[model samples]
Target: MEFLELPKRTSGNRTYGLTSIIDLGTPTEDLKNILNDYHHIIDTAKIGFGSACVTPNLKKKIDLYKEYHIKPYCGGTLFEKCYYQKKIPEYLTSLRDLGIECIEISNGTLNIPMQERLNIISQIKKDFHVIAEVGSKDSNQEMPISEWKDEMKLLLEAGCDYVITEGRDSGTAGIYEKDGNIRSNLISELIKDIDSKKIIFEAPTPKHQMYFIKEIGANVNLGNVKLTDVLVLEAQRRGLRSETFYLEDRECKLPL
Candidate 1:
């Protein structure tokens, strides 16, 4: 069965080649079905935009994700909401009660001072694994490349387990222009200065995913992938799809 050769991919739980899927009100049954088929390839599942706060079967979903060894966490907006409302202790307790061990800390919508953000990350690291997201959600609020690099470094140094580049669920903000075009120069600068493996780029669209796969190789860490696109993304990573088919050597002959 091991007939075709392809570049090696890190194991699912490993730090590299991570794929973080988004759970935006996916029904429990639908989510279970997806996990039943593709759990092995998914690294994390983010409960999108405070959905976990309102989803009736949040605990059930969290338990299912844990059973499959997938880290489940609330979206950053939920964390921001709790923080601004001065309910962080309650938020952490709720997460614990829900059997969630991971959380995202981001200031994409609310502008928390950088030092304060780092302090929050440090505090959160004590009880939960933190995935610190950098970049603004506002399409017009472009940040200088230096600031991006610095913030990423600071988050990592502040004890964040991973750093996520801001690509809103729509894939039209943060690293992408309003038209969904990537800021290639900014990304290039970040890659040049930071460890690509330590950062996850949110690529919600096929075009964005293809660009990252081709530009950063098949093992790039990607996030915000839709549940339906999980298998498709895996195909692209293995060069089974047209966009990456050239990654394999066509000239090689298989044994008859």
Candidate 2:
């Protein structure tokens, strides 16, 4: 069935316009069913928060995501937990044994200094694809725009494949206001000098998704998405959804 033209999107192992879903303990059978239907559009699946440490059949889930070429990784909070517990080596070994290929290193909750964090990223980069997150999970703690850009630059230079802004799965912190609204000025300022392609904005709501698709174009990398929202998000990205019905034309602006 040939369809009408829609917004162009990179497909099959996409580098841009990535949709990273948060898998917070969906059963293996259920995950298989969902992946069977929507895996092609899912670039990565994050086991939300510290849930990966206790999820039964963890390796099976990781293997399934890998089978579809979707990068599977535990959330950064889990890494913080491991680091605090002085089990960083054990954590990495367990994840490697589980067939995981990518890792997210973040200081969202911990106070790991920039130099130490960089050193950690340097070490981790040798074994896996590293994605560093920059921002505090605390809403009251506002990082200056310059600091955000500076840290992101340093992380990318340290060999992180991408840098993620800390918008928690709830969508009520980090890049967002407490009420779940985006800080448009902050986004504008941060992207003024930094590359949006190297950052994955944690957009977990329909509004967030539409805003990014309209403002940053269809190729914007979005994370912390719910499993149920996958198809609709993809539709929105393609301008098939009414919120972004005109995105095919608007997306030409690119990498703002």
Candidate 3:
């Protein structure tokens, strides 16, 4: 029997409807299994935190991802470590050697100067696709909405391919509150001034993903998703899951 079709979504290469899953050092064999089953839904794979630094057979794993047409890149924390340790050049070289064409530049853990961050984006944009993240990972540090908008604009102008809204792995830091609830007002204000298509919201949890799909439309760019949740999130996006099944109703209209 034929399955019900999903709402139209952009192609995997398109700027919108992208889902970036985190590769938190899964074993190469398991990663291959995941890619084999869900590569079509996975647009990008982020080697989370500093796991890329310690994962064995790193090059082989990266190669596997590339073979499956999944864009893989190191997480922003790795960039912060390299930047603070004065190893930016070396880091870039090593990434290239490992066949990583995309890179995430974030100042979540490091207090990188704005000018320096822009400079780094500019430099890296020449050799790699840049995903610049805006926001502090520390829950205690709250940035004004105006500042968040300004930073996102600066990062885009500085040549970042896409700007990421910082939501840590737990979905409790950055754009989210300590309890993992999204700061809806702040996000609304930020998106009002910026293009939603250019922003990848890090929604690690099912609830967060469902919320974005309902609030921002089906094609919202979401990131920091766990490897196993890739297909599940796609199901929600397609109104295949109970939480979002109402989307399939002909008379239902989404909130503006």
| Candidate with best TM-score | 2
Query: How many collisions per candidate?
Result: 0, 0, 0
lDDT, candidate 3, 1-256, per-residue tens: 1477656566756667889999887999998888898988889999998899899999999999999998999999999999999999999999999999999998999999999998887777889999999999999888998899999999998888899999999998889999888999998897788888889999998999998888777788999999888888988988889988876434222222
Q: Give the per-residue lDDT digits (tens) of candidate 2, residues 87-157.
A: 99999898889988899999999988999989988888989999999999999988998899999999999
Write the number of the candidate with greater TM-score, choosing between 1 and 2. Answer: 2
Order the numbered candidates by lDDT, best leading: 2, 3, 1
As for model 3, its CA RMSD to the true structure in angstroms is 2.4
Which stretches of candidate 1 lie above 4 Å from their native place? 248-256
